[model samples]
Target: MEINHKIKDQITGFIAANSLVLIVMAITKYFLPPFGGGNVIIFSEFVILPFLMGIVSAWCWRKINISTRKQSAWTIYNTVIAIVLSFLVLKEGMICLVIVSPLLFAFILLGTYAGKAMFKRNNQTLNASVFVMLFGIFIADSLSVHRYENKVADTITVNAPPTEVWKYVVAYKRIEKKSDFWLFRMGMPSPVQSTAEGYYLGAKRKCIFSNGYVFDEKIVTYDENKDLTFDITNQPRDPEIMGHIDILRGQFLLKDNGNGTTRLTGNSWYRLYVFPVWYYDIWAESVTRNVHLRVMEHIKELAEAK
Candidate 1:
């Protein structure tokens, strides 16, 4: 028997059958914290919109009357897909989320709706299952989190002096103008507009995504010619069920290689306590380190060209 298929069946069935659990779990995940954290966030942490989805799903599994065997087989197959997608999500964050979120949601719906007659053939059952899975993500993310960390360093010897690089870093807006959202992505202009002054501590700026998602960035440190760090100090507009996720951090360090070369390093750290992650930090660091260096190279090109 394919264990993979069975896992999918269970996820779908559980979601379709346990709507109440999903609702409760969603609320729990959205609001509860790991142990030590600030409550500048009152009931500030919300999860209701998420759980209602589950309430709808459980109703579907029962109404559809999906067979136990089929549910098991499908779930097993989906588990394999879920595992692969989980690793990708941990590694790539929003990039992976954009892709996996849709596929997983689609399959989950399929498992919930396609298997009818086990409980009772009802169209509402299909609708309910979709809500159940959406709600469960809230609970699942709250209950367990898989995290990992990665560290990376890059050495780039700019012909220019460290002070020169610092100036360019300070004037990043000049290096590359912020790109606008394509017409297809969002109906609105790229909301890269923010009052956050560049390279200054406490500077704040707003960034809008193609999905109408919005977050604001705030500078935490502005060490001249040495290090620059900032944090996105707001909650995700897309999934407003959870507490403020602005706890995440990002850093850029410029070190003199003691030679003509300079070492410019970058790091990013973000996590959901409930998610079990052993090395997401490492993975994120590796990816962002190069990403920053590349940005530095572009800066170098611009500065040199002038």
Candidate 2:
């Protein structure tokens, strides 16, 4: 009977900790508006909230004499549960969750250890102070504007000259080949085709993705056989994946190699509303590079075939 009672207490503690974490997360999301109309803030979602969850979990389970390994395991388990619940409640895509899991786990573990150390002393003042500091930081981060514009570029050598490459750069046929990029395979959209209505500045262009979503673009800079730049007038708001990111503009630059070859460069400018710019930017740059490669490679093939 004692053993069963202990097990029941442990289960209850675990449930209570996770419930508190989820409640805090939902409340934070409600109070803090996302930078650009999205519902995710990197600091709160990935760092602060997870850290607080860890501390709270440790406090809830403080009476249980568990090994460090077990505590770590429980923390990880809590993270996984939170992620699953986020997916179900927030309707976030699998790819987003996959990308966010590592950061969430890391911070949660840190919090768990910190919490254990603090609670081991049973010092109420320290705990309260820490909680207040974290809340202050969260409020400061929320109030500060986090609009960041970043640019990513990829270059490829094409066998065709600038003129030939220019034809495809302006517009290309459907890409029938499948993208080998792992992310795209996992439901992140890949570019499929591009169509242009006119051949000069102010012309309308549409870049279509495999998901049947189209990016409405307008030609802002058009230099025949040299530069083709377009502003993204409108893009999809799927909310599950890339909706939080705003793709501002894109450009294709062609340079004559003078030996029947051309140097083709693709550039993309975007603003991501997510926080912790260092981490998310890596994924953003990689995704942008791959997208550029897919389109540029298609252009290369078509230009060379002509």
Candidate 3:
């Protein structure tokens, strides 16, 4: 009977800890400002909140007399549950969730270890003080402003001269070739065609993607076969992932190699609203590079064709 009673207590503690973690997540999301524009992904969401959830889980386990040896496994299990719940309840895209999983797991584990150390002496004062400090940090982080801008460029050597490449750079027909980019294959938008209303500055340009989404661009700088630059006047609104990023400008620079070939370089400037710029920037750069390559490759094919 004692063994059964102990098992029941463990189960009860597990349930309570998980419930508290979910509640904390919901409350934190409610209080934090929405991502993008004036709001950004703060440290609290990726770091502090997971840490607090770990501590809360440890507290519940300690109250139910769970052994220290088993706390690590229990904490991991609790975090997995919480993540699954977030995916279901929040309706987050799989790509976004996958990208964030590593950070969440790492911080939660650190918090669990910290909690273990704090509870060893069973000091309520220390625990309360730490909680207060964490809360203060969260508040301060929320009130601060964070904006990040990044640039990515891709260069390709085309078999044609600057004049031939320049024709396609201004505007091109539909790309009939299938995209080989992994992200585009997985449903991320890929460029399909581009059209220009005029051949001079202030011309209206439209770059259409496979998903029927079009990027509205205005020609800011036009230098015949040498340089073409445009500002993104409008972007697609349908894709949920697009909400976290804004593309500011795009440019194509054509240089004559003087050996019957041209060097085509594509440049883009964008702002990312996601947190931990170091991590997401890699993805952003990769996606942008692939987009540039895809478009430039199509231009190469057309320009080189007899």
Best by lDDT: 2
Q: Please provide, for model 2 over 1-306, each residue's C-alpha lDDT reduced to its tens digit, 9 standing for 90 to 100.
A: 867766765666567766876786676667645533454465665688788878877777777788889878887788788788878887778888888888888888888888889999988999899999998887777667677779999999999889889888888999999899999998898999999998999999999998898999999999999999999999987655455578999999999999999999999999887878888888989999999999999999999999
Better of 1 and 2 by lDDT: 2
Q: Rank the candidates by TM-score, best first.
A: 2, 3, 1
Cα lDDT for residue 305, model 3? 94
What lDDT, from 0 to 1, does candidate 3 have? 0.80
What ranking of all candidate models by lDDT puts the best one first? Answer: 2, 3, 1
The TM-score of candidate 1 is 0.45
Q: State candidate 2's TM-score.
A: 0.92
lDDT tens digits by residue: candidate 3, 19-113: 76667656656864553335356667678878876776566555456665576676667667766876788666666666677777777778877
C-alpha RMSD (angstroms) for model 1:
11.2
lDDT of 1 by residue, 103-197 (tens): 34444445344434323544666657755775566455444433333334555656655666776654454223443323223232233222345
Instruction: Provide the RMSD of all predictions against the true structure, rounded to 1 decimal.
Output: 11.2, 2.1, 3.4
How do all models score by TM-score?
0.45, 0.92, 0.83
Error of 3 at 85 (Å): 3.9
